[model samples]
Target: MSRRDPYIIRRLNFRKVVVVTLISLLLVILILFAFITESDIPFNLQNRIRVHREHPSLILVDLMPAFVFILLYPMHRIMNRAIGEYEDRVKESQMIVDRNTKFARELSEGEDPEPYPEMIESELGKALRMIQLNIKSGRRKEKEQTWIAEGKDIISKILREYHDPGELSYQILQALNGYIQATQGAFYVFDEVEGRLTNTATYAYNRRKYVTQEFRIGQGLVGQCAYEMDFIHRTEIPDDYVTITSGILGDRKPGSILLVPLITNEALQGVLEFAFINPRIPKLTIQYLLELGEIIARTLLNLKLNLRTRELQEESRQLTEVLRRNEQQLQENAREMQSAQQKLESANIQLENKIVEANHAQSRLHLLLEYASEVISIYDESFRLTWISPSVINILGYTVEEMMGGKDMERIGRNDVVRIRKMLEQLKESPGRIEQLEYSFIRKNGERIFLRTYCRNMLEDSSIGGFVLNTTDITESKQVEKEQRLKSRMQSLSENSLDLIMRLSASGMIHYVNPVVEDYTGIAPGSILNRSCGDVAFQKEFAELMGRILSEMNRRPVKKNLQATLPMLMGEYRAERILSVDAIPEFLDGELETILVVGHDITEAKRIEKEIKVQNRKVQDSITYAERIQSSILPEPAHIRKAFPKSFIYY
Candidate 1:
């Protein structure tokens, strides 16, 4: 009933009760008057007495029923009004409950749960509370049935074809649309390198548009969800917020959103956000959406982890194949290189013989010096002051007298003189061009000459003539070439060495390591290097192995071929290595005096060995099968017994 209807009924009942009570009293008075007039005995006296004596019971009888009726009417009206109000409230509450239950069931049923609440405050909160209650009540069986079937199909398709995590995430968003109504959404995960959450997947109504966005840990709505580890309500968000959702949703306006936290174990995974086109959606429905979002988050995390594992596995397989191909190529190239090297060596020897013959034919012959090419002299076996060719003035910037001065040794740097002496000695043994070496000589101007010279020793009948020098200034080239060669040689050694070569200082710091360690440990070079190799590469088991191998070899340089398995790599590895440890009192590059470690990588060899084992098993199986067949070709035991009974089967 409307609020005013009960008051109208009560007023009408009160008026009817008053009218009935008056009519009943009038009837009683008339009856008493008629009775007194009909009797006619002392009429005047009796009428006076009767009028004076009123019966209490009769008066009460006339008014009691009307009084009771009037009193009961108001009481009944009050009771009815209260009950009616209560029933109305129950019905309204039931309607809200039903809506919530429907939303959850629909989600379980793979039906689109509407997105009305943007940020928890409005109708969305009520909607979410209802959904929570329904879920708690376990009334989502029907919904879960449909969701399970559809979700299974979706997950199957993702596993079968969507290898890329981004693509799989997109498919996941699409599948979520089957359950929740949303205009846009995004998936994010933490980037370990950058230490921030980055968008890995997105679902927007307009596929043609794009958004460039990022969030700090606690900067925006999504960030709050991640950092606070709780749901962020839209109504709770302040205006003039730093995080403008406009770029994500087309127009630059604040829309209602419910930022739900996605967390697993001890880590905050990410936040899921739903954008609504219509702002009037009830808060309760939005709550329902948040619960659904949690499910999606869990599934996404698991799929992502699985995808990463698969990627690692695939990468390992590809690397192994590449390594195998490279090894084969190296073997073939080594053969071809050997043949080419022999040919080159023979050609060099023949050229040396011809040059020797030409030098012997011309003694003290003056060949006019060309541009930058000159005749020069160094001491013979006695190491005395030698003759200076006239071309020395042009090449060394010194006159012949100064070049041939008795103090020529004093004029050059100790290093330069030592190198020249070395070169002359080398010439006596072999005739070849002297490689460019850093040296300083005194110019005629008395300035130090930092020159890079290429020289060839003058030889006569396998004996040293004076050394012929061709020098040039190379102060800049020396520095540049030294750095270039250092880097080049380091890179080449890292790539070409079959062994795992690492350099360490006395502090046990790993300065450098080859890439071959990954084959044995499955840990990437980037992850392990620069860290303590003893801690990471040689864990408890491998460390023990190293100690044991060192001790068992009786301190002698040893060779070991071993097999081991690491739990992280999920496989066994066979390694063949030669350990030649020698103490260096003064090692190059200031290395530890007691440190000398040499080991080679033999993962491929180990793999081949395993393959050989498998092949051997197959061969054994084949032989057993063949033997069975051969035995089958022979006579039965009973027949053999019968045939050999007399001779006791001696044959």
Candidate 2:
């Protein structure tokens, strides 16, 4: 564009020169004609000119106009050239503006515009390219992070909602397959006892081929992934590699195969297989899968643990049921033997058997209590302890003897005692109802602790005449509650805040956006979530500024404060707002989590500031005007003294 500028400028200069010289010549011609045709001229002017030829002064007078014309021509040319140069500069500046405008438009439209070869070295062009690079890189980062976050959410939901690894593995593979845009997928879990990887699920599987498939470590691609516990990507597919099958398209060869091992803490748990026909998977997606492997593996391990725990709980419940029946039988037999001691001698043998069963039940009950991590104590109506679990030593740092009859065993708060007493009275009246209480306590070792106590009224029962209290240490849970409350408060502050608050990852991925952003950006927080900042429809300058800020933050991790004007759509009107934004880095456990952005709308404040400045200037001008008027109208000291000799000047 600038290459032809010199030619255009030279042509303009030449045209100016021609116009000025032609006008000057025309004026000279007109003067000559006026003089030639003049009737008012003296008849002896020519004769006088000839007669004064000998006079040097007349000759000088005759040549004065020629000398003046010669002197002024160069000045006229110089002025014309200067004006032409100014016009040329205005043209070039306009061109630059037009070029910049075009580049901005292209960038906004998501088109990568190239600068002219000659303009590449210019600062404006370089900055434009840099901004383009920043935005594009931010977009890629956003996409990669979104994929990883979404995959994790899906896998986490599966882990929470399902306990069966069979169903869970399928769900995980299905989500990964869809997310990766793969043609086919499969999942396998490693069985430690069997020393093999067993297929748990397959994408679009046929019912006939639903039978489980197993492979020893180092046998196949899936086995290799499990054996090495690393990713396996192959662009070349073997003819015999026919794991992907379909009823409509049977035995279709894949273009590529990607196997990822699910590992947690350096331990292999499973392998994931994905097949792509065109081998167009993004490297970012592969990297995401690698990072997500740990979470998946951990979830699988948790699921297996949960299954084992449920089995153990079932067995425990069965044992408890047996213990209850045996205790009831033992009580019945003892009553029978007491009533018919003389008549029934066979009752002794039955009583012995029942006692033996009762002892076994008692021993099992004690074992259960030991593993239950709870303390069971009996308290009489007067709150006197009768019996306490032997587990109190471990749970409360106090032995059963110390807690059963010890003074100053607990120090309930003054305010909590009333509520607790009220609950106890209700239990006494109900005779069978259970009441739960939570309170802070001072242990025997003088350590402050928290307890959750559940008490049931059993005074009406012949076997048990006191209240049964089941107590558990809940100090750790209380700490969790405190942290949860703090988190809730922070979320509440963000939700109710007037300022726009958003969280962005270090790479410019939007993690969260407050609803207030919608008011200024005309974009809903929902639409902006999990998206790139560059992809948002922000005002031109603001979009570029956001990209620049992200780039700077990545380069140098520091808090950034920037001001921007954003366009907003109000009800039936459009408006622009000036916002002051604070971009602060948020870290968790020494790792960068997100960038916290708080944007405060300062448009109204800025407007009022401008108005105040204008008002102050006006007031200052009024004061200056008054001072000027006073100075002009003031009387001299001498005049005042003359008017009143007795009066003296205040100064």
Candidate 3:
């Protein structure tokens, strides 16, 4: 219903009032003329005849007002209808202006603008459309300005938090995703050292399910964007292109994908990828994305340079500390040498005055050797111990007095005796060089201990020494090396397994995930750690089922094998996969601790099973149809028997 304008009604009323007033005045004039003609006043006959002849048409004029009055209602109705239509058009034009104003405000506020009204062929509608176009242009300009200001603000924030590249990338990606209403996005930074692109952060994405984290300069869409240093937008995405999953809603096929390269100063720094549910992104939005991409590129470059500067500063600090420590050590060594020189000079001065005191000095040297950790023994040419340090008691479980005259080789292992003899012979042959050998020796307690022995022959010692042996226990170090090798092997096996392996806490939070998850779910392992399984499940039912299973496993604290049909996201599609999961519960002190889950992907088998069921149903339908055809076409047994009765038919 169109609203009537008050102005149009007032104008119509004014026209009616004028027509009535004119009719009333003409009636008055006619009445006055009749009165004058019938008055008693005398008049000339000639004047009366002239006046009568001139006023001949006055009678016709007197009837004209009546005819006008008769047509007044029809004329007023026509004029009113025309005026109402004009008022309706004005109202429509006002509505268009109001709607355009709203759209313009929304644009300036950085909100989604409403679409333009449909075009109308009427003149008023055409004028409204032109007005809307002009308004939209102004709104778009305002939106661009708003976007520019927002981008600048975001870039400033990113710069403030640019100390860590991972954090910076995450913040930038989150901001971009929010601005564009993206379903998912990832940021990949170019690693100059590795010569590849590596995923640094993601928004609404499972990094553990990312199949490929490293890309060459021209590898895929992300790499291609980097190579071209431009943005790539695809609206009609293929089914298996990429998968984006949200909690409980399952996986979704993206309607559009955008890959933008972050390039600054002719250098490719990174790539940003976004998945969107909207197929047709607005032109203004695209322009904003491009401008934001430039800001991100420059920011990334700055982050790299800042990181390099920090690294260099850290290295310089470390080098300075090392040099300072080395200088201190060198000064200490020089002081020790000077003190030793002064002691030697004092000993030379006292040698002539007291030969007995010099002999006592040798005994003090032997006493100092007993305080060392390593066992020191002096042997004669026959390999008999002439003197031994008290450390021999700790290393060989033998007293110094008992080992003083005993053969040093007596406690050596039978297998190592020949090697010991060979080392001793080599020391004797090359007295200028020291000989080192590792061997095992039996202690007094009958325990075998590995020892690394350094032997040096004394050629001109008047104190009657053949060789000085320094032996260090190396048993603990050898054991540590053996354990490290075993651990390395185990870690390699776990990392290379083809099954999806995960470890979860008793509370159902993921503690670890192996690399095989990437092959199945396209998520990276590092991204899922410490996150609840419910947060990453493909469906709500799956999350609930897993929670229940985890609770039961925690209660039972036992190993279990289970089979379930789960919805798994494969690329941009959701597939019902049959998973054969093995849950191994780990316990400490009889209490449940962690659970290890290993799952095998059985989607292909499930697909084959569904196909077989479909085929079997078709076969059953065919068999039923065949039975019906036989029943319809073939004669009844009774009728056949009747027809063949004369011929003596037999069954």
Candidate 4:
């Protein structure tokens, strides 16, 4: 139910009070009248009341109960005030409750609820706000701690990941800069010998001030930070300083600068300078940097030490190598003398072994070349055959001695000599260029043999005087290629022919089909391959025609030409086509193996013939009718001759 207005409720409560008070007054008055006039009055009191009826005290005392009604007005006023005050207290309590509820709801919804009433008398509100502030503060502290930990983890990883001093400094500085959201940063490694700092790496430095950046101790902020081994943070930056940028364009002036010294074991390793766009860097990032400075310094120092140690070890190895080389030279000299003596004694023995080994190698080589199908030959710059394998006789029907002194053009086919010369010239232009030429060579028996020569030009080489040729007889391959060409041409013509062609086995199962069958029969060639042409799905007319033709062939080689009208499915209708098909049978050893059927579409031709016949019949009937009319209209041959001596009737 909806709440009633406070004034209305107050009025209703006041009316109830007034009614009860008046009713009580009326009851008292009635009771007073009954007691005063009835038996409750004593005889003496009744006589006194009659005698002093005019006296005020006697009348007042006798009608005191009736007089109680006088207090009703004041009582009404009192009860009205009391109820109004009660309503006010209730309204205040409800408003306070609502306010508290709204405050808690807003807090739960992650709203600031800043303008809400925080009455001083309300202790709960104060306590709740306190709790919220405390939780927010704690969360912020936790987040900062996490952020710092993350930064520290990043730096620690960078330190452990790289060993080179330059890379280590660069990666750590870059990480620190990004973790702090700095606009630009630079890292400088200190040179201990020169007591100076050298800028090693930079992160997004827009303008480099020097080609080789170097600063002596106490020269500038970078050097001072290294010399003093302390961190410096500057918030009031000069206006003339470089503008800050993050992604593409310059945004604004940087508001702060930070220089951190890298110190470990009382030795300066490097210095890091970072610039941030914000006036104040986050304490978490600052703390992270301060804590990581020593780690980075230690890593850099370790890398430098390791590099120095590696250099020292390399130098030592070089010294050792020098000494060992000296010792090896002396030993080599001594061994050379001893080997010279030994070689002098074993010279004849080695010569005999070499002769025997050469003879064995020659036998092996000759045996390989004798049976090898391919011939390996060497030619000079003039294209003269210097060396030819023994297999040349078997391959080209020529003895090795007969081919050795001949020029290449003398044996090559006359028609291909020009092509061979061009190929040879190309081969000679570039040494070590391998090329192949297929040319026919004239054999000793006056037969032309094709050779696929794989030649490599080595014209200027001392070992092989001219080209190294590997020739393989390809005469059989050439004949097979020619036959393949013929077969391919025939296949091309058959497939592209206008007539639909199909080859079937003796039992009428399809063996092969050309693509044109799809246009004539509305059937895909591949789908009908190896399938019977007498399937029920085909048009009944075609099936009957092929069936009759095949049946007749089984009995005897009857009519080979078939004329049939097949209805083609055209969308929602059927189009009848007249196909004149011819059956050709192929026999192997006088037995039918397969039959080839050729279908020629003649739908247009049949339509034109039928139209012409109809037109001719109409013309002949009209001509006979005209002749009859002309004879009927003629008066006589005598009348026409009288009108004109040479009158003639044209029909």
Candidate 5:
């Protein structure tokens, strides 16, 4: 249908239809005039027939504008219907935005909300209301759960975050006012330091300020709430009510207050005061604030507990370090004590060994001094005898008991005792020695024996420990030595005289024959020495005489003379000889029983005795001459007769 142009179809209107209809009518009249002028049967009937048949296409075109108007007329009603529906939808969307904005704002403030408007209610309001309710319920559940699970953590945090209860009280007021969409309220915190309630948080319209004034508990509405430990809801405030924060709230001209004490299990920690921007807030709205206030209280308690726990943890760590240091010091002290004990034990062992060695040395010294032949004694610094060796009992002829009792000193000669004391005193001052001095000591048997003493001073620290005495008995030795000298002189005289001197062993062998033996027997000692005296001498009987002499050598008083007659082998003779003999047995050349004999020859005297018969008469005559000399010195017999007439003189 490219043939139809609607723009062209719409351009023709009723005025154009009128103008085109007039021009068509005028044209038909002109065509009819030409047909009638040509003379046809009846002119008037001819016009009517011509009009019905002529211009059928022009009549169809004239009806096109009317058809176009009918068609465009239905489109105008359709356009108006569409415009009205669009306007209604716009109004509904605008209402939804307004209602949702109100819902969001109310929910954020924690207000008890009303339903949305009807316009939005049929659209998105139902869903939004359900979501808001769920949000509120979830928030309440979450708060309760946190209070249970982390209550202590919350209390500790609150105590750390807000130093003063008043500061926290203001936070609660702000929270309440924000939720209610009312900008007026007050908060009272219990000031335990000041022992009163302080108005802390306040809001009036768009303004906020803190009031530091305090009131006694039960002094006003706020105080009364803390004192009673209960909440006060006052919708109509009395004229006489005490006002603590007066000019702070804007919309709360003289609004009524609700005072609630922030109570825990313990006494009141703080109090809260609220004023509605209006005379009173909704009951449900205040209840909502009350529930939130409970959360704040629980959090404050938890904050206190957690702060204490953290402090304890720090303290425990410090204590552990101190304990570790103490343990280390104790261990070091124990080690030092053990080392000291070991050193003491080692020193004790060495001391014991030294004591043993000293005792052994003392025992040996005692034994040696006891067995010595010499008498040994020790004295103390006071000159009192302390100890003497056991040999004193044998050598000094005294018992140990006697010596210990000072009896031995009493037996010493008086002069020797004095000398010993003087020597001891000198040794005490200056220590020295005294060699072999003769001292006499009386033995226990009352024999005064000569003692040869050797003494030395024993000193300790320049003072006399005592004196040591070494004594020997020499009385018998002196007697024996005197006898030996006499024997030697007699032997020398006999050897030079007309006598025979000889020494013989105990077995009768001749040991020595002096020169006199050769002169008498005409035999040299060389021929007679070691030969039996019986064989060398003239008679065997002489050997028996020599044997008898040697046997009696040790006997006392060997001075004896004998007369004998013998014949010599060199000449025939019967001559008489007088012999004076001395014999001694002596130890010679380490052999026992050697005899010394000295015999004098008086043979010439025997011859003179034979020649003179009056030898006995001469001995008698000499006795008469000795008597006559003795009478010369006597008084006369007459004198004796005159002196004693009654007595006869006996001559």
Candidate 6:
């Protein structure tokens, strides 16, 4: 019945059996001895034996067996107890090994392992411990890889969308804080010129209070991290280290803080600091932070380098333009000198040659102004035009002769004339300094043109002792801006409308959708654009109706209005929505180009209508039932006749 039964025979008690056997043997021997001592012996053998028994050696031999048995039995009992305890320990050790093996198997299969309570001090325990360590290490490594991958995706998205350093820093800090479960964090970028770190962005920071925004290289934990180009993780945070606040719980000190330096190419770019309420942060989290720091640092450096490159390129372009203008001016000066030298050689023809050279110079300047869309004119101190470039004919619809001798003011609006007078006075007071003014001027064709004019006093030159004005037309740009403003107003109105508005091309492809569509269909407008209307309609009948409408649109006249009631899918549940849609066709150049559809959600209205109909039907049924009850209560005409067989008695 029991496992030990196989080894045991008849369930014998060894101690009892040994005692009984020894007693029996001793009794038999004693009986034999008595016989030898008391009975008659053959041939005098018993008499000889009795004589030797009186000696000391024979007496000692008789007592030895009893002493040996007494000592050996007690020793056997003690040894048996020790062996039982050792056997129990061995069984316990074997169980521990089996449990550990099961746990290891579960872990390998990516399942949670059962808890093992037995502690084994054998080789199996040490091996199991090593396996557990390896499993933990592997899990940590997987978590780190996943975290780093997600962090990289976030960082890349930030870099792609934001170019401003402040915006990038803020997004990066917010993302990092969320990933690391930090209650508070800040990003500090190194300012090379100031030799200090400046706080560029912060997460969960109070803006109304004064926060430390600047740090020296070795000032605090943040600064030290940057200086050392390493990270610091502290769990034994002091009470005064950092405070975290919750709206429900109020303020408390953070349990841990981490400071990491964003370093790339052996150079410190910035420092990132985070405070957490958890006292024990996983080492994988720290690894993620370090990897993120390197990526952020490299990305920031690239952004800065790109910005610097753009600035340099812009400066170079400006310098090149300046050089080009200077060279053109030098060429003009050279031509003028050549003309003067020729005039000096022929003084008799000097005045004629001078007039020709002056005309040539003016023509060349006019050609340049025309190519640049500029109008140049010289004005006297009395606001009289002395000279004007012929390009004014193209810019302001005014010929050079019409613009000369202050006649250009006739085309200038009255308000502009007044503004020009004030600008002239200012120009006289600040000679050789340029002033810019933008105003509207009447063109020769009675059209108002917007022009930006640069005015500078040329008082130092004796030949032209007044001001030079260069004007550029800007009417087209002004018109475009006005149109843009009107478009923006229309867009705002469409976006806020309650009814769903959409535009579809002649081919029935969705072209545009307003924001209200998302509210009705629970799908973003952007997700459905360029798709056929039939594809998105929920019901088969609605899809068929849409196909029919698109097919008839080509044959229908412009401005034809069509209406339909169709069911649409609503929300994640795909609930039926009854929509009353109105499609209005828009025509361009006598051809239908697009259809604008406006849909009103009428699902609730339809439900109410159905309920009203059901109530009416119930009311009719009640009336019929009441009539049947009245018929049963009252007698029929034939029954009344039978019952009133004695109708004559009534008469």
Best by TM-score: 4
Model 3 lDDT, full chain set: 0.70
Q: State residue 408's C-alpha deviation in candidate 2, in Å.
A: 79
Residue 314, model 3: lDDT of 100
- Quick one: best lDDT, which candidate? 2
The segments of candidate 5 whose C-alpha lies over 4 angstroms from its true place after superposition are 1-333, 379-386, 393-398, 405-433, 438-451, 457-466, 472-497, 500-576, 580-599, 612-651
Task: Kindly list the per-residue Cα lDDT of model 4 for residues 427-478, writing each as its tens digit.
Answer: 9899766788887788877888888987878676554668888789899988
As for lDDT, the candidate ahead, 1 or 2, is: 2
TM-score of each: 0.27, 0.40, 0.32, 0.41, 0.28, 0.34
lDDT of 5: 0.62
Poorest lDDT segment (10 consecutive residues) of candidate 6: 241-250
Q: Which stretches of candidate 3 lie over 4 Å from their true place?
A: 1-132, 205-212, 238-252, 327-651
Candidate 6 error regions (>4 Å): 1-122, 194-196, 205-258, 276-287, 331-651
How far does residue 603 in candidate 1 sit from its true spot (Å)? 99
- Candidate ranking under lDDT, highest first, comes to 2, 4, 6, 3, 5, 1
Which regions of candidate 1 are displaced past 4 Å?
Answer: 1-163, 171-179, 204-208, 236-239, 242-247, 277-287, 325-651
Off by over 4 Å in 2: 1-47, 50-61, 67-75, 98-121, 205-211, 242-250, 314-651
Q: How accurate is candidate 2 locally (lDDT)?
A: 0.73
lDDT of 1: 0.57
Q: Candidate 3 on 181-216: residue-level lDDT in tens? A: 877888888976555788877676433223336665
TM value for model 3: 0.32
lDDT of 5 at 205: 55
For candidate 6, the per-residue lDDT at 540 reads 65
Candidate 5 weakest ten by summed lDDT:
1-10
